[model samples]
Target: MIEIKRLKFSYGETPILNIDELLIPYGEDCLFLGNSGSGKTTLLHILAGLIKPMEGEVILAEENITNLKTHEMDDFRGRNIGLIFQKHHLVHALSVIENLLLAQYLGGLPKDLNRIYQALDDVNVLHRKKAKVYELSQGEAQRVSIARAMLNKPKIILADEPTSSLDDENCERVIELLQYQAEKYDATMVITTHDQRIKKRFENSITLR
Candidate 1:
């Protein structure tokens, strides 16, 4: 769960995000709708503890971690949050399984081979476990990223326009995997997107004007 109040942020005196108040509870999937420059990414970064807000508090899992040191924030974010980006940020040289294993190791999570394999299996990429990251198609690589995000079994999942590039079928696959993992982990999911395809799946959506 996440709670924010009077959160304000700026880039060199120019305000980019000014969230009045927001609350997301467990077992919830939310769609955040915003146009270009509507501060969607800014807000998501704040939630992910990637930026320090000029004002307000970020409370996650009962920790009012408004002032955690950068290293602490990084560790917390790694273990607690899973992020899915539109472009799969995979290392081209590593094999599919290696990329996922690296993330788990970076987060200092337990390196359970079965868990890793199960994650890949969930994304329907278990067979590609030995394939190099660059060998995957866009859709396959996206699944690899999804696998990496869920590799640590994070309690919160944040995705940025995950379905924007794919066809409808692939889009469905993308969304379905996210929702399924959210349920599997009982994680709160907050997705930022301009795409309308995910609107129906979210019970509630926040629109930025």
Candidate 2:
């Protein structure tokens, strides 16, 4: 459940996004396709309430996030949105489980060890939960990222360029994992990317020129 209207955003004098209206229903998986400089990431940030649009209304989960205060936006995002960045921003010094715990703490949620372990297990990373992030392979680290994102059972999951740098096998695996987790938690999944390999996989897509 996401809706945007009269969305316009700019960086200084240059316009970045100019979406008139968009809607995504609950439990749907949508792909945002665009080339470099096409503002795919900018649109994702706006949807996640990480940036404010110059003029627009971003209604997520029946609330207009564009009007929320800073702290209120942060709290709402923490509780309702799960973000997966392309870089997989895990703390290298912390163990996999520790990184997950930090996310829970930052989200103002109680630390549920059983939930954390179940998340890891869902991503097939429970075996590496005690290992430091730096010790994981690229795939393992990405799995851990997925686990962390789903730890809170968010209502929406946003992934940015998730399959950009992976081999075909890993790319497929990542998409499957994202869809699996989304279905498991009944969350809407939105993935933004320029990767053509994934274009045919999603029936619902928005292309930015």
Candidate 3:
């Protein structure tokens, strides 16, 4: 679950986000709709603890992340949050399974091969586990990214502009995959995008100015 209160973020003298209060309950899926420059991604970063707000609190699963120390926040984020960015961010040279192993190592979690395989299997990418990231098609790469994000069984999944570059079919497929993985793990899903193709997909949503 997530809660934010009096949240405000700015860059230099300009304000980016000024949310008063927001909440998303456990296992819920929410969409953040916004035009370009509307701060949808900024809000997502704040929720993920990747950026600090100028004032207010971002509480995730009962802990106020805004107050956590750098290392503490890093540990909490790695353990509790999964991030899927517009870019896959996979190491092109590494195989799909190797990329996942690296994620676990970077998160300071033990390398659980079985968990990696399960995640890949859930995303329907198990057969491509040994292929290099650069060798995958766009859809396959995206699925691999989802697999890596879910490998840790995070409590919240934050996806930023996930379907922005896809065609209609791939867009729907990605959304379905995201929902499936989130439900499978019982993780709250929050996606930020300006894509109208998915506007009606989520019942819980908010639009940013």
Per-residue alpha-carbon lDDT of model 2 for 1-209, expressed as tens digits? Answer: 88889999999999999989888888888999999999999999999999999998999989999999999999999888999988889998799999999989988899899999999999899999899988999999998999999999998899999999889999999999999988888888889999999988899998988
TM-score of 1: 0.96
- Cα lDDT tens digits for candidate 1, 1-209: 88899999888978887888889898788899998888888888888888889999988766676788988988998898899998999988789989988999888888888998999999999999999987899999999899999999888899988998989999988999899999999999989988888788888899976
In model 3, what are the clashing residue pairs, if there are any? none
lDDT of 1 at 94: 89
User: Using Cα atoms with residue i matched to residue i, what is each candidate's TM-score against the true structure?
Assistant: 0.96, 0.98, 0.97
Worst 10 residues of 1 by lDDT: 58-67
> Which RMSD values do the candidates have, in order?
1.1, 0.8, 0.9
Ranked by TM-score, the better of candidates 1 and 3 is: 3
Per-residue lDDT of 166 in model 3: 89
* Model 1 stretches with alpha carbons more than 4 Å out: none
Q: Model 2 clash pairs?
A: none
Instruction: Output the TM-score of candidate 3.
Output: 0.97
Candidate 1 global lDDT: 0.89
